[model samples]
Target: MQACQVEQLLADYGTEIYRYCRRLAGFGPDGEDLYQQTFLRLLEADLEPDEGRSPRALLYSVATGLWRNESRKRSRRAAIARPVELDGDDPPPLAGGEEPEAEALKAAENRALAAAVERLPDKYRAAVLLAYGAELPLEEVARIEKLPKGTVKSRLHKARLLLKKEMEARGYGREEL
Candidate 1:
């Protein structure tokens, strides 16, 4: 494709692409780095598509490769690193709520939910984050993860059940869970 066409494609889909990267990397400064790397790889590759080409599919394929390579690197580093503490460092509650105490409780619940997501196994975590956090279609997520569509569905269902269980155990209750 031409440069302008590529630029337009990026402009149209960039937010979703970055959000996908955030899910893949578990949402942090590291995720932002991976997001940038995904775009860099796309540009560098010029997104050359072979027979049966779909630009969106090509972009997703590149993103998946980048994420997989980074995941491998992270696994190696994780093997040597000490386990980090998981804290429910609650962000400040929104100030305008009619009930300040309720808002504070909600904020705490949000933090606990985030921590629970962080605690999930990488595969399930990826599925949850991509399906819910990034709001991607299950089919697209399956494509990105290189899994069968049904497997992606299964992973997301299992992940949600696990997350709900953990959040409920933490006293998050139905509203928060």
Candidate 2:
């Protein structure tokens, strides 16, 4: 793609792509770094999607690889480093709601849902995040995951059950979400 085209793509999709990265990377500086890296990789690859497909899907597919690679690297580092006690800092609530109390509650609920998603095993997590977080269709998610459609569907079904159970266990529910 031309420079102008690339810039346009970034302008159009950058925030959504960054949000996806943040969700995938959990919480930290690394998420922003990975977001940058995804674009860098895209530029390096200079890929054009085949006909009938949006480049948006390709952007996410690239982001997924970058996120997974970084996750693995972090896990390896954590294994080497001695464990430190967690500080239990809660992320600040999202901005803007009619009631401050309602906003705070909503933030807590979102955080809990994110944590629940984070707890999923790698395969299930990737499938669920790609299908739901990025809002990609099941067919697109299956393509990104390089899995059969049936397998992706089965995995998503299991992931949904797990997420529902996790939320309920934490005293939240689908209604709350």
TM-score of each: 0.72, 0.80
lDDT tens digits by residue: candidate 2, 24-136 = 77657877887888788877778766699888888888888887787788789989995686855534433444345877677788887788788798789888888888789
Top candidate, metric lDDT:
2
Q: How accurate is candidate 1 locally (lDDT)?
A: 0.73
Model 2, CA-based lDDT: 0.80
Clashing pairs in 2: none
Cα lDDT computed for each candidate against the true fold: 0.73, 0.80
| Candidate 2 clash figure, as a count | 0
Worst 10 residues of 2 by lDDT: 90-99
What value does the lDDT take at residue 71 in candidate 1?
76
